[model samples]
Target: MHIELKYGNRKLQGEIPFDAQLLQPCIPPPAENPALQVHRALDRPLAVAPFEQIFSAGERVVIVTSDITRYTGSEIYLPILVERLNACGIADTDISILIALGIHRPQTEAEHRKILGPLFGRIKVFDHACDDPAQLVELGETSAGIPVAVNRRVVETDRVIVTGTVGFHYFAGFGGGRKGLVPGVAARKTCMASHFSVFNKAPQTGKHPQATAGVLDDNPVHHNLLEAARMVRCDLLINTVLSPQKEILGVYAGELEAAHLAACEQVQDLYQPRTERVDLAIISSGGEPKDINLIQAQKALDYGCRAVREGGTIVLLAACRDGFGHEHFYPWFDYQDLAQFEAALRENYQINGQTAHSLLSKARRFRVIMVSEFDAEITARMGMEKARDLQQAIDMAHANLSSMPKTLVIPDGGLVLPHQFVKVKTFADPA
Candidate 1:
């Protein structure tokens, strides 16, 4: 059968053997009227007061939003949020946008305009400078001994309204509400400190237990992040759940935790699909921007890791036009040994370093093949075989496998949590 998977900016066609299974999430159709849904969410918010009730006239409001890497329906929702604020008597001039960079590099002007769309020049738009001490406001330390410092704009603002899409985050349980406060606007030290708590030398044993995706109760990372959000007073949280195509599926608004939890449930109901393990998994990071770099594309690879059988091969289709996508990530790939990688990460501990560590952790179990625009030499150094295209990737997979291989193809790999729905039958279950 012929299948066209997502490439950088376009689609790449490939052939899957007739016997191979083509697996994808059973995603529902997009919300019929996204704009109307946004308005309805605002009017009937979850646990907090409405937007109009929260903000008064002549107040400085900081609208914290996710950066370009996250596929938050910010372009569609930000304008609506601004309009809601406008109706609440807050002028456009008084409202500002702070792009949450965490430890990621600052976004370019083109990206800023692209992400915000209609509201780019209309309001004051600023990037959260995580490294700059002058821009951060210290808000004391969490019980876990991590210093909490966030962007001063969010902290000082009379009302901090957060807008972003919710999805299953690998570490922080879920993304959207509290995340926009912690790593979104947090200082570099704070982000590093909180992130460091989740790393363990033995990933297979699940030593990083609290860091699992879709888990909120007793999750240390989420707890610390929510503590920071409370410190900054996350007054209004508007988080959207997206379909595999990045279309709005559901919008949850109002109180920080409640609204975000509701959105996370919606995501789980939409993204989780039951599947058996496959010997070969052909996965894509859902095209351009998601595949723009190795760092962002690694998440989809992780999803593949969860779905593929042990010792099986993963053929990852990511454009990776921006190369490794992080300054610290490529260096760690040089260390062939896990101990060496972990030691270096513990010593230096950069954000990208963590992602590299994760990649290495997965490499321990499964073989990964790359089909991207990245140079072959670069991916080879990272212990991944580079294929010119999808045909080459499939051929390489066939060569690596000892027996007939069953296949699973995830077109939108990053959207679904494959790990959650894998069937694990106990001895007591009926055969």
Candidate 2:
């Protein structure tokens, strides 16, 4: 099969050999991190599963995952998820699936199979369906002027399991909680409403975690998510934190509040992206899967850019393992020499401008360097100063570097996803 792959504003054609085997998910398998050993070390301290938790003695169980799950692969919490439920005595037959689509297109059966992998015929796999735009049901409005509505399928399920990785989210305090319900199952009005506040554009202090954490309680968007999860009687939440290799380093399962908190702690251990001030920041998705989609790809530039000095540069390291997911993002990705991508935002067609306006907004002060296994010509047009290798990106940064007087690097930018509650660094700085 011949398929076209695209990055920002660039496309390539490739032929998958007729006999080529499809890729399979292989969890890197983590051992343990002592500082993060609370769950295991304290396993004895955890309460036994409640006999009548959620579904009761005889009822159905349904599992739903975050919309962030990708096609290349994700450590789909299937085993850990199922085993947890089974330990509580729930049968597999009573469990099904729901891939939260959010505002994105519904998962094709093929994509579902990948997300479902072995889940094909064994489990009654399903995806969140709200194709008829009118079907979204409103639960209520939040104090933030955001309306809250949810997919009826998730709402009406006998007992629902919410699953997602716990990482620092741009708006919400963490990614696993109410977000899955908002954009995942909640009506667009509620999703748009909660987001209608001044959250997304809030200034991010390059080195301070406290600045971000302080805003959480006042965040209208976050409050909306908590309110909705309660309204639906969300049974249990299962959240994960992946290692640098994307292994499930930690799993938080149980009560809604506790589960999320546990996952956040794990997230803080690995992904606390803090840098006082740097002459240059070298960042990237650390290659495939994480770098596969631009939606997920921009994170690297976002963090690295903030930590950099004025007129400093961010050299992004990405093989873009899969390339950009949304086709519309490709055309807007040119103009390499400039420190900005303004035309798209100021132009007539902002539809194509969404990605640029966003990147430019995030990348205001610093220049960007893109070194990847991607086509050179296209990346050049996308406003990224192209480089051939990791060292070269650094060399380029070093050559023109400015006053900040230091460099902070994240070898796996995407894997370093942070959670606000993870707490700030202290002992590391003896100064």
Candidate maximizing TM-score: 1
Local accuracy of candidate 2 as per-residue lDDT tens digits, 171-228: 4556675656666676544554554442233333121232132135565555666766
Candidate 2 minimal-lDDT segment of 10 residues: 16-25
How would you encode candidate 1's per-residue C-alpha lDDT over 250-320 as one tens digit per residue?
Answer: 88899988999899888877777667887888898889768888888888887667778788889999998
- The true-versus-predicted C-alpha distance at residue 260 of model 1, in Å, is 0.6
Query: Scored by Cα lDDT, where does model 1 land?
Result: 0.81
RMSD of each: 4.1, 9.6
lDDT of each: 0.81, 0.55
